[model samples]
Target chain A: MIQRRPDWLAGYGLLSPAIIIMAVMMVTPLLAMVALSFWTQQGFELDRSFTLANYFALVEPSSEPTYWMGIPFPLTYPVPAILLIKSLAMSLAITLAVIALAYPMAYFLAFHVRGQKALWLVLLTIPFWTSYLLRVFAWKIMLGFNGAINSGLKSLGILTEPLSFLLYNPLAVMITLIHAWVAFAVLPIFVSLDKIDRSYLEAATDLGDSRLRRFLQVTLPLSAPGTIGAALLVFIPTVGDYVTPTLVGGPSGTMIGNLIQELFLKQNNAPLGAAVSITMMVTIAAIVTLFLWLIGFRRLRSRAR
Target chain B: MQRIKFIDRMASGRIDRRTMLRQAGAFGVGLLVLPRLPQAAEVLTCLEWAGYDSPDYFKSYTAKHGGAPNFSIFSGEEDALAKVLAGFKADVMHPCNYSVNRFVNAKVAAEIDTTKLSNWKDVFPALQMASGVVMDGKVVMAPADWGNSSIAYRTDLVDPEYAKNESWSIFYDDKYAGKVCMLDNEIAITIGMMVGGEKYETAAVATGEKLAAAAKEWGTKVVKNSRFLWNDPSELQQALASGEVVAAYAWNDVYRNLKRENIPVAYAKPKEGYFTWFCGLTMLNTGKADPALAYDFIDAWLSPDTGKQLIEGSGYGHANMKSFEISDKQAITDMGITDPAEHMKQGTLLIQVSDAVQTEWNKAWGDLKALKQ
Candidate 1:
């Protein structure tokens, strides 16, 4: 009675469809983006001139200082360098803020609450069920000088006049983005927390470890992967976002995404816009790769023990 | 054992070979055929501003014509131009005078044959030759609608005495710092340059340095005080109705809507002179359909009766002079045009700037944004 082994060729056949689809959909677009970064537009049509001018413009400093002694200083211009810096700062700020608010809420659902986990998840997702633009608009109304918040405060005699710091500023943009992306940060952390085995906590406690210590040594390390994934998920999209900034950010709150939009839409400079996009993509990829490598190296060292 | 193994191996090989071949064939066929599908439509499509193609205004024309004109509205000239360059198929476009040169330079629009338009003589001469309208020694746009950018404020919130005066300085006052509003567009920002006594040059020819200097100086002031920089008329309306803003740079149509809703709003006559924009319709090279339909649509829009309907519906002034006779003079007066000729003379037409100048302007805007409180 001899048995036949399973065929490896059949398994490859099953995966070929997905492999082909990915090459056409994802790989081709990425190649095109890289190619477009090098091409410049002549009038309306794109010309295939391979030039480093776009990349040079991105990293170059202003030709003149913004101000001088006594006399009005020559105007200082913002190149791609400044825009990229500003975008990174805004994205990081939003990511940190969201994580700070979401982690505790996710923890409450996973550990503190017994059953009602499904109920709370639905509540967390309620804000997102509405239109994205509408939700932002609602936030704008609530924060406006004559909005409910200011009106309520005025009625309570908390202050004399409507608060001027309500909307159309960096604070407004930050707050709105946090509200918009809270669900994104919460779900991942929740899943990570849920996956932690109860036996690990029991083992730590049996050894006379404190509750905080148990969490710090065991739970935090286990959830690092989810935390990193959530951070990237929020950071990458927020960096390229223009809608929120445009609606809520005043002149002082303009971001790199706004500049990219202006270049492609208003200035008709696609090559320069493409250059900015490529630079951002590469920067994000490098940072993410470095982070993963560090995590992998640590895992290997721990396993050796 | 050998017989069973041979049968299993044969089945696996057949399956793998068949699947791989099918995928390759599908991919090759899709790649070859996808790029050639005609994205261009057989009929002319007009890309216009939002209110230009309201159902009330164009329903009659659509019914009379064999087929209704295809139209899509854009928020701004830059948005329209961006869509066109992205290979959006449109046979005609409605951009303001300031943007015509860029359209022509980009070869997105075709030169107009003045003879094709029966109402060509009715167009305002200033609009026909405005710095933004010239392209290769030809008139590329037939003027469609005209309006002035003026200050709109809440009569109840702003003091009546201060509202009567015409001054750009009003927007900079501390009293209105948190209550005031302005457009987040280059044209509105350039008004600050005009008030500062900067020499006027067509944006198409202005040097990058000049634009940057103007942007930096004006941007600092505008950003420091502006409570909100609105992107659309609706946003301005929200600001006004909610009392978040007592005063703002606005169009006549905005004032008209507020008035109809019984909200207290009025247009101020700024002393420095109002900044104005003139928009017109022009044919694009992409139109493969009857150019006649495009011509008919323009003709209908310019006719006295149709022009009256458009003005009344959209609250924008008609380019056709005859339409004024049919429209109520009192209504026009309420729109802040007591004397059309005088207003036109005192007004400055917004001009399109070259790419280099625009870059300088953006830098200046950035510097202003970077200013510390």
Candidate 2:
């Protein structure tokens, strides 16, 4: 009998690189944050003693008016809960706006372009080539009180004074975010739309379905995975984004991410920040899980398979 | 520069084709054969604010030591403290007066032998004796420069009624809603203290005894009125110049720069008093560089020549009093440092509040900052 090399070794060897990288890059930081969340910080010294004070502080109640929706939030430490909800709400709006905006462009690229589809895609992504900060800065200038729009409109005798409602508002934040994250949303939806089999649409048409009917029944279902995937990608990251809000959100622009930053850097309460981060992650995870469950995730996934 | 060096080496007959090839081969062989080693640590790394690394500030030291010390730039002292605490080594670090004790408390900053610094005596005695600069008879930080935090408002855009009165309430003025910029720092809290009608002290800030209601009102009103929170001075300057905002909480440089551009601007001498800051250098305990060299570098920074350059260039009040006499008179006036010595004596300086106070202040700030958003 000849000894044979185990096939499992090759499989494991192939997976080892990703595993090691994940372990070092993702898993280690996550574990460190979890550990830090339980530790107490006294000035420069960190007490390794396990305590739940940081977590408790996050929910310590105050006499301020209860939140209208009754989210059971601690009124005293309301910043985190409020920011989280605001972030989630804004991120959802951003996602919906992005999907609504990108789908048409993706659909056009997928079906309408006779040739140079790559060129069209390349052109679409040109706006994304510049730095994100630069793009946000451009928006700031455009939406500023004395910005281009105001000056141009003023010169045209449209108004006496610059519009005060233009920048440093939620609308400005949402608009900038939708623009920034649209590129990311476009690619996935485009891939899904492009991968749709023509025969399915032909079959729908042969069944005497109108163009709109065919799209709603066949094309839409086939492309659900990409649109949903793009949404998840955009929503998850945007929920934690601080940069855009900081630049444009004005008084209302600060999100949970900014609060997290405050805790870690400015407030010198790393443990609290870590706890808040964990809380946010859990909340997002719950929301995402429920959304997937409601949308029949298993059935959709099986169909994809 | 490397090309020039190679050419010079070749022109000087130090390296020809044959020798160059021989050296290259030797270097490659040595790299492969020898054990890798860490490069030698820089002799004197000084972690400083951007533009503070200019050779003019330390020309005296450079002349004596053959070259300028290694410089690392930081935007904020909190960031600098974070870096230093995380083991970023430098012989000297520049931290503002309020935060000197933070470094000392963390044990990242070492005491200076004032005896080593010849120009130490010439730095205004008041600045040298500022609260956090000296602790328990040990000099932790040598006073270098100071800047004022006050309102810089467009004379053309703002109402004369508000500007006429020296009050921080200009920030809370509803007439300028969505048209004001503000500093997003502890200085804002001090501004809040002023608005709250309570005299600012560590005691009031540390214990929200009388400031809670006032702080809430201030935060609500100020955030409502402010168009944005400015982190960079340039942002405030641009906002003011563009007529985007009628007023902003600004440093002295913003006033000077706006003045130079012929903008109708005025630095507010608020009745609440300006938030004056004295930032300076402190030796790091972890520094392996020669103490004498670090001392020399510090002395150079304290020299009147450097002070004049600092005053004329950046519009900051240098610690050395004699620099006032030698500096450009107009520039000094523009910097509002013509009578800096007198001002320093009467200035409302920042203090290092206790940790409990810091936590309360931060909590209040976080609540207030997030409340409107």
Candidate 3:
């Protein structure tokens, strides 16, 4: 006689390896980070205590007064809060710009270009084949004061003076991020666009609908998942990006990730770094959740199901 | 390169097609039959910076032992400390004076038996008892390389008069507004302390209140005026070379590199004082290392021959005075160290501040960077 096994048992068995891996690799570190967020760091020691001081320090004011233009200004803005807000704003800008640039290219690849689509896609990803650090360095070279663009423009008599505005600013950081991570945006949008049934457009045409109307009615709604995916892919990573900013993001362009890196690396304050990391992660997760909600989470779930 | 090698092999005609095929089959069989073996332990493991691992610096040890010590290199001391504390067992670890205290306090580094070290007497007297090297009258570190953090200006771009009267405040001067760069580290904040009139002792161990006050003064002046903050050597070089930045808070090596190319750059002896730092070796308390071998490694690193090689090859000042004997006065002057002892005394050494102070300094820096206006 054979004993009947529960179906869920088989499912659990199939998922055990992945579950174990995720638990070990992702969840453990996340839990440790959470624990560390509550701890405090002294000169060379980590004091494990259940205190909210690390988080509080994020909002602690500099009691000293700063005078800008002879008007007394209080140090009301906490560093962490300002950095968080700055990172969010910058990431949003980069995400929007990347989507704006990539959507058209992806659409062109998926819908318009008929020959050697694979080749075009491969060529699009050629820049990505090199290291991200290398690409960022290349951008630095290209955007420098006496860099390729400046020298080229100077040689062509486009301008007499080399432009200093091209590099080491928020604009440069945004430009580099778009170039570096735009491919991440492209592939997702391309997948969604490519998956759209051509018959839907044909049906709209048959119904005497205009192309714009057809896109608004069907194409836009159908590609929402991919667009959201693209936004998430670009927004989340760029928000925590310190390297690009450190490389090109002059005085004004420092991001939250730089602060965290300093705390963990240079300052040797792991607890503070942990707190910052947890806060940044939670903030990103919340933003992602809101984004999903705005784009109809239920619909996305149903589509996946 | 692999293609060239294949072509060469074919051209050589050492093996015909049949032989090559047979050999290929044999190789494929060999690959499957090959057994994995445990690696032999190499004594005198040192975790250090890039240039320290050069064969020239460790010739005596390699020549005697028939192998170079195992090496694991770190770009920064913070990383080295973290790795060592996290159970990375190296016989010796390289750390600067600023970070040696952390290693000692954490017990990742054991007190060095200086009596066992032959070249211990040769290390600079100032560095022998430098802030982090000596704790409780015990020398925990064998001091090695030293360099100064000073202002490096393009002689052609910056005025000779202004460069002559070098002040830390030059970094914040509105006259050089987009033409100035600063190092992206806490060292800048330390420079800021000096710029804000904080004393050396106060600056070295500044706590929350002191840090805030200092930051309020210095942050407003310098942080905003900086065109960029560079950490990488190449980036700093590019900025100066292209006339993008006329002046930068940089290491002595930057001065050396520029002058080598005849780029008309000068290292400033800032009136506030040059920010000097020294790096050295410490024996890790890993309990795995053979103590005798570790002592030998330290001695070899501090030996006159090694010191000579370090200065000649890496263009850094070694702790041993005998090392300077190998070089001419011109080379010494060019290195911005005409008198080592005098220079060390004149320069303010970077020391480990309380973690609380570090946090405050970091916060101030963050606010400075976040300052839009």
Candidate 4:
């Protein structure tokens, strides 16, 4: 007659390592950031007073909200809020575009390729072998006014003038991001697509389903997990990316990350930067949670079977 | 051949316990000596910019002390300040005149006892007591090198007459649209303020609203006509050399670099005056190194030979004016100013602006850089 082991204790034992890691690495810093969000900075000194001044000013309208680019009350919102909204929009666009572009690629690798699968996978990761900054600067060299594209065009007599529009734009930013993040997108999606049983496709085909119909009925539903995984991988990091924008986005391409960096590193205002960071993290978390709730992970798992 | 085979087999994981013990013993011996190999000599650490760290500049000190100093560099003064304030110490630090005040006020730097510096009398008078060099009636910074921020232009592309009438307004000229690059710094706003005809004294402590308004107009205007905002000096240098941009808000160093390469570049004497800056050595208060050694390092930096290399190699003005005699005539002539002190009188020296003013400038720059209009 041994004492029965409690289910809760066993579960806690199993999770203790991860729980400790989360508490030390993630939760502690998160708590510190939350506390800092309530503090204020005067000049070079950080005042530890619990106040809402930073949050209030974050949403405060300018004394005179003049229109620029025909947008109404463009300066109505403060710096952090405006940049956060812009970065979110940019990230969403990149996520959707990347996923859409990545799906067919993953499909091809999963189904169409017959030999040297490992070689193809290695080739796909070649861009990542170099430094991320170097890769981004490589894009800068290609897109710059006097860079590869414009120089090539000029030399070929296709264009008399170097194109200024190719670089330092949001379009350039997205292009670089797609290149930077494609491997992240491809691997997860490819793994999901690859993991699908071939018999499912055969079974769907045997029931008089067309190729596209078979893909929709069986293939698409099974690959949802990888697509979701790929989206999170690409979207979460791109929202806070500033170096890409700093190097290639030119004047019109600054993101919230740059503002947060300036606030913390340059302006001696860690509290405000912390507030911005917390706000951004919460916003992203809320949006992702809402998305998961709408899609229903349980539904995805059941459908995969 | 049998021994080689045995070694290869050992490497391939076929080693016996005895062989493994031998390999481990070899590694242990290697590790014991590795830390003392290259740096057995006493290191005199100097924190400075990219070009200043070379052993060539510290030859006098090295010749005297029997070893070269260790080098660490910071891209900007703010970064250097942050590092020093966070207790990163060095024997000597190079900060511009405008930023040395922050180091003084923060007590991150110690006062320089000028009597110890051998070349103290040879340094130019203007730089010796320049803003932020002196604190509590003692010199805290020994002036080393100086330069000006002005338009560096392709003489082959832009007309000499137009460039001669230079103002910061050249950055706003639509004639150079999609062909101009400006520095991406808070100092770029100073150029804007200069072109806008704002008084420097007033602009340094302007209210946030006033700063916002002024920067919105002037900063936005500069960005509107520019092709890109360059964070690194080399970017503008490449752009100018490649004929991508005809003109850029560049330093005298860029002018020197292009001229050395025969790239037909010139530093403009803008009507609004150049934004002059001075660089010098500041002794770290928290430095664990010998004070006398630090003073020797500063003296070496200000010595005429080091100053010669500064003028000829780096293309920046040295505080020891006698270095001008040692510098090549062509190099001095190509720089367009033999006397830095005289040139400084014709320009404006950048001073430390208040924290509030800096914050507003940073905000305005962020907003303006992102705004399409």
Q: All models: lDDT?
A: 0.72, 0.81, 0.78, 0.79
Between candidates 2 and 4, the TM-score winner: 2
> On residues B1-373, what C-alpha lDDT tens digit does candidate 4 reach at each position?
9668755554454555555467668878989887664545346677887666777676799989988777777656665666665467677889887777777766678888898888999888877776667767778888888888888888888877776587677787777787788877766666777677876666656666777777777777778778788756777788899888889988777788888899988788787777777879999887777788898898898998988887887678888978888888877876667666776776787787655565666666666765553
lDDT for A177 (candidate 1): 88
Of 2 and 3, the candidate ranking higher by TM-score = 2
Say which prediction, candidate 3 or candidate 4, comes out ahead on lDDT.
4
| Model 3 stretches with alpha carbons more than 4 Å out | A1-7, A59-77, A297-305, B1-37, B42-56, B61-91, B124-132, B196-199, B275-277, B286-296, B310-315, B333-339, B346-373
Across B1-373, the per-residue lDDT of candidate 1 in tens digits comes to 9546644654565434554466568879989988776664466588876656665555445776656678877767767777888888887888877777767876778877777777667765655665555676886887777777888888899887876686676666777776788776666456776677653454324455666565556655666677767666777787798787888888877887888889988777777776677777877876666787777677666666666765675567767777777877666665555333455666776677765555455445544554323
Q: Which of candidates 1 and 2 reaches a greater DockQ?
A: 1
Model 1 residue B160 lDDT?
77
Top model number, lDDT: 2
Sort order, TM-score high to low: 2, 4, 1, 3
Instruction: Tell me the deviation in Å of residue B10 in model 2.
Output: 50
Interface RMSD of each: 6.8, 15.0, 15.8, 11.3
RMSD of each: 5.4, 8.7, 9.5, 7.0
Angstrom error at residue B39, model 4: 11
Best candidate, TM-score-wise? 2
Worst 10 residues of 4 chain B by lDDT: B11-20
Tens digits of lDDT, candidate 2, A1-305: 32333555435444566998999999999999999999988877789999998888778888765452455554667778888888899899999999999999899999999889989889988988899999999998888877889989999999898897888777898899999989989999999999999999889999999999999888988899999999999999999988988888776777889888778877777898899999999999999999889789666686798
Model 3, B1-373: lDDT tens digits are 9556644544444334454466567868999988968766546778877556778876777777788788987756666776665567788888888877767777788888889988888777877777777878888888888878888898888877976688878876789888888876655666777776777667766666666676667665676667777656667887788788889988766777777888989888888887777888888887465788788778888888887766665467888878888766666665766445666677877777654554566556656665544
Per-residue C-alpha lDDT of model 3 across residues A30-55, encoded as one tens digit per residue: 99989999999876678987999888
TM-score of each: 0.84, 0.87, 0.83, 0.86
| Local lDDT at A266 for model 3 | 59
DockQ of candidate model 2: 0.22
